[model samples]
Target: MTILIALLSGLVFGVAFGFLLEKSRVFEPGVVVAQMQLRNFILIKVWFSAIVTILIVVTLLRELGIVTLHPKPVLLIGDLVGGLLIGTGMTLAGGCPAMIMAQIGAGYRDAWFVVLGGLAGLAAYLTLELLLRPLPADGPGPLTLAGLSGTPFPALAVAVGVGLFACVIALERLRPWRLDLGAQADGIHHDRPGSPRRP
Candidate 1:
């Protein structure tokens, strides 16, 4: 019963997440590619905002004893390799896993290929897991910033969330979201320098 409830909760949250992503237009191929090329700030803004919000929510849940924090083992080598692979794939596909799903939901035909490629990659990784040994035997035990810094989890979460939220605000101010949208309210492409100002 608990498992079934958890699954239903996940379904609800997943739908909400996808709806938000679609509305934000961050799942668009152009937007994703622009972000990878550092030509747009919308993706980073959304990413940081999500991170900060999650951190705060999780901290509150922990304080209320509604959830427990379980840090994963710090496998530096595995993380580096996985990050490189995921980053390369995302750059090539112009969408990460989550973004690709949203793209498909938004009626993008090309996103299907990206999804297949991701599954192929996963299959390849599983087949080569033994030979590649990406997960080494030795890794730093599950460690959290709070544990490392000898601070309470709630305090660390608050500090980190505040810092990231500040960054999000600064980014929005420096490069307004409308600039990255590629088209202004007047339907003019004035993102480039020397372009006619929006009326």
Candidate 2:
């Protein structure tokens, strides 16, 4: 009933959000590159805004009994390693694994290889985990951001918001936004967004 409604709502919202991301020029190569270059601000703004809103909303929900904050202990070694790998791959590939998905749906054929590679990587990892057991990291739980810091939820949320706000302001000063020019009119960027550089 309510759970089903909420799940449906989340799916609907995600689809709507993907469509909006496509429309907003947020998923462009120039945008990602600028973020890497420390030039673009919109991507920073959106992500920061999302984090801020989620932290505040989740904290409130937990307080109201609408949500629970059940978190497992953090494993910094694995997290740091995973982040480094994901970041390095994203930097080299010009697209994060998640964005690779959006690219695929938008008709970019090159994304097929990336997706395949990702599948292979996952399969390899699973095979290794089955053999090694605790060789890498063992986890039987979920981790939340607030759990790692041990700060009050409201304070953590505020801290995150302030930090993200600072980042947004800093990136905005770089003026990374580019005009669409005639690209939209031609329906080229409208399909496989950002720039034509990404595969």
Candidate 3:
């Protein structure tokens, strides 16, 4: 019963997350590619906003004893390699895993190929897991900023969340998101003649 409840809760949150992503239109291929090229700020804005929100929620849950925090042991080499691979794939596909799902929901025909490619990558990783085992060991044990800094988790969470939220606001002020969307409000490039192109 507990497992079922947890599954249902996860399902609800997943739907809500997808709905928010769709409403923000950050899952659009143009926006994703623009972000990869550093041509826009919408993707970062959404990411920082989500990070702040999750930090606050998780902190509150921990304080109320509703959830426990578990930091994973650091595996520097594996993390670096995995991040590089995923980043490269995202740049090529113009969408990350979550965004790909949202893209499919938004009627993008190309997202199917991204999904297949991800599956192929997963298979490759599984096959290489044994050979990569030696490089996976990196750190002594689990670590967290709070533990390293000798601060309470709640305090650290609040400080980090507030700082990120401020950054989100600043980003919005610097680049009004509408400008990132072409004049037609679509993701495609539609620069006008004599208009200055942003670097």
User: What is the C-alpha local distance difference test score of candidate 2?
Assistant: 0.65
lDDT of model 1 at position 169: 88
- Candidate 3 TM-score to native: 0.85
Over the stretch 58-156, how does candidate 1's per-residue lDDT look in tens digits?
A: 878889999987888887877787789888888899788888999898888888999888889889988998987846546787888888999988888
Question: CA lDDT of each candidate?
Answer: 0.81, 0.65, 0.84
Per-residue lDDT tens digits for candidate 2, residues 66-133, read 98666754555566677898877775555776566666667768768877888898999888876655
Tens-digit lDDT track of model 3 for 92-182: 8978888899889888888999999889988998998898888978666788999899998888888898888888888889888878877
In model 3, which runs have C-alpha deviations exceeding 4 angstroms? 1-12, 184-186, 192-199
Q: Name the 10 consecutive residues with the lowest summed lDDT in model 3.
A: 183-192
How do all models score by TM-score? 0.84, 0.71, 0.85
Error of 2 at 92 (Å): 2.5
